[model samples]
Target: MTTKRILLYAALAAGAFISVFPYLLVVLTAFKTKAQLNSTEPWLPGVPPTLDNLGRLLGGDFPQYILNTVIMTVLLTLGQLVFTTFAAYAFARLRFRGRDVLFWLYMATMMVPSAVTMIPLFLIMRELDLVNTWYGLLAPYILGTPYGIFLMRQFFKGLPAGLEEAARIDGAGPLTVLVRILLPLCRPALGTLTIITVISSWNSFLWPLIITSGDATKVVTVAIAALKVGIGVDYNLMMAGGLIALAPMVAVFVFFQKYIVRSVVLTGLK
Candidate 1:
């Protein structure tokens, strides 16, 4: 058992190092000079690190991209929380005709790849005159996603019924009970959903690229992509921008890592 535990620890450590290697390389490259970045010498770590690349990134349109990403992340997270929680609650506890059938249909949509829906969704947005607007980016997410609803529904199912019963005994309306009792108890699930939505929305590339043209609605990922030129790419500047884009995600993970882990555990418990 001791030997097996040691082996497991070794394997886990190796996996973690492998995962972090690329990020470490990016951080190193972010601080390298343009010559160092493109030189035949290894890009792993520059002999003398410099912040000139980082300064260039800070001086550009990177700040606007960060703002756009934050706005999109916050909007998408809040929208998903509200809509998914309500839909999940209804699906979990409410008894209406065709509820199961409707939920099944919703779940089926999950099997459909986003690539398949991209062109049609874009056309619809264009027709509605939502192109090149924040609304264009946020509108699709406002309707609640199937995976979010599924997660919330599972969490709601695990909740005890007596809380709602007690709330009713106190003359609390259904909405009041949901808001005051159910939502509070579902914090872990909500945290998980928030993390997932924020990260996904923040890192989104293809769809946002397809819908929003130019700086009108350019997100951080798109902005980073645009930094590359036709023939020669500025590796240092691009890495600096990439590092800046990664800071928020790292901050979120550092602050909410505990809650995120608990949420994942609760998910498996269900």
Candidate 2:
């Protein structure tokens, strides 16, 4: 092979190692005992791999945290998908006064940092007495996101107009066209949205920590944060919890990776 091609391959290999090394450390650390974790060989694999950390985590409130995270992720993803799909379809296909202006104005919100809205959202939740409730944890997110709407809108715009026109000629209304025709055709985009939404909701820490309290409402991310004791961080248990929290997202990405790539490629085409 040419020297230039060899250099390119070496660069790619270095980048891949950099990306995966932390995760490899976490996984290795998860199996190690607390003693091994604290010892000089902390960077190495467990001397004798143990499931004590996993056992302890599952035996405690961690399972409940996992369940809560799953429930919140599923509910929020469904709500966002529904809301974003309708909004995107309207923005892409319908002609209303100031539609372009309104859509652009809404999309501009994405430029604003989420931190800027956190206070106002928290105050709104407090006013509604939803503080520490599941509703509060979900309310700000279920309404759809500017990015999700933008993605769906782009995909919708890329679709052939004639499909909707044909559906309309067949006595289908706008809602019917959306539900029966457009939605089925938008599977790749929907899959991409579902994966993104699920992962975001699952990994959300700050909002959940702020809105939720106690074991009853705490999600996996908050539960994992609670692992930090006053004395010192328990790296083994923390890594175990991290792996547990990461498993679902990994599974999701593995399953829907193709669709995600397809959506990106198609969105670029649009």
Candidate 3:
């Protein structure tokens, strides 16, 4: 048993090293000068790495890109949380006409490839004169996604019925019960949903690239891609921007990691 434990630890360590090495390399490369970056020994930066590239990115539109990404992600996440929670509540508690069929149909959308719908979405945006605008960029995400609904439904289903029942008995309407009792108890699920929604919106590339053509509406992912060309592919500036873009996601994950894990565990428990 001791030997088996030793092997398992060794394997896990090896896996961790493999996963972390690329990011370390990227970070190291980001500190190197162009001459050093292009050199055969570019894999490692020397004793005193410079922050020149970071400075350059900070001086450019990278700051604006970061701001835009934050705004867009926050807006989209807020909309998703409200919409998904309500939809999930309805599906889990309410008895209505075609509820099951409608839910099934919504879930069916998860199976469809996003690429298949891009053209139609683009055309609709154009028709609405929302193209090249922040509203246009965020409009698609404002509608709660199928995956969000599905996740919330699962979490909502796992909730005990007693609390809601007690609230109803206390002269609480459905909305009152949801707002006062259900939602407060749903902190773990809400945290999980926020983490997922924020990450997806932050990392989104293709849709933002296709829809927003100007800086006014461009998101971090698209901005990052443009940086490659804008700075003549200056590796350090690009890396700095990449790191900046990733900071919010990392902070969010760190903050809510416990609840996110709990939510996942509970989903499986049900």
Candidate 4:
């Protein structure tokens, strides 16, 4: 048993190093200057590391891209959470006409590839005169997704029915009971959702690419692509931009990752 455990620890340590090596290289490269590149020692950690790459990346239009992405991400995350929670609570507890049918119909849409709907959605946005505006960028995604509704509904179902009954006996309204009682206990699932939402919103490229024009509304992902297009052959600066773009997702995951593990463990969602 001791030998097996020792071997397991050694294997885990090796795997950790292997996974972390690329990120470490990015960090080192982010700090390097154009002069630091060597054909012989490509991965060389430069002595007296310079901040020229980072300075150039941050001291330009890149921050606007980051700011736009951040704004959209926050809006989408909050919008999904609020709307998803309300819809899930209704589906789980409220008895309404065509309830299950409506839910399943909505869920069925999730099976369809988003790409299939993109053109139609863009046409609608353009018809609404939302093109090249924040409204256009946000309109498509502000509503809760089917997957979010399903996850929340399942979690809501797994809770004891008696809890809501007890709240009702205490004269709590449906909204009150959901907000005060259920949401408190849904931290793990919500956290998991938040992490997923933030990452998805942050990395969103395709729809934003279609909706936004020029520098005004370009997101981090678009800006990164622009770096390759505009500033050809500045690898160090590009890596610096990548590091900046990567930081928020890293922070969000570090903060909310426990919820992901806990949600899987408690909710039995794969």
Model 2 stretches astray by more than 4 angstroms:
267-270
Q: How many backbone clashes does every candidate have?
A: 0, 0, 0, 0
lDDT of each: 0.88, 0.89, 0.83, 0.85
- Residue 141 accuracy (lDDT) in model 1: 81
For each of the candidates, the C-alpha root-mean-square deviation to the true structure, in angstroms, is: 1.7, 1.6, 2.0, 2.4
Model 2 earns a TM-score of 0.94
**What is candidate 4's lDDT per residue for 1-270, written digit by digit as tens?**
699999999999999999988887878888877778553255678887889988887889988888899899999999999999999999999999999999999999999998888899889988999888888998777779988889999889988999999999999999999999999988877976777788889999888888888788889988876677653577787788888988987786687677766755755662
Candidate 2 weakest ten by summed lDDT: 261-270
- What's model 4's overall lDDT? 0.85
Judging by lDDT against the true structure, name the best candidate.
2
TM-score of each: 0.94, 0.94, 0.92, 0.89
lDDT of 3 by residue, 91-119 (tens): 98989999999999989988999989888
TM-score of decoy 3: 0.92
- Candidate with more favorable, higher TM-score: 2 or 3: 2
Worst 10 residues of 3 by lDDT: 39-48
Q: Rank the candidates by lDDT, best first.
A: 2, 1, 4, 3
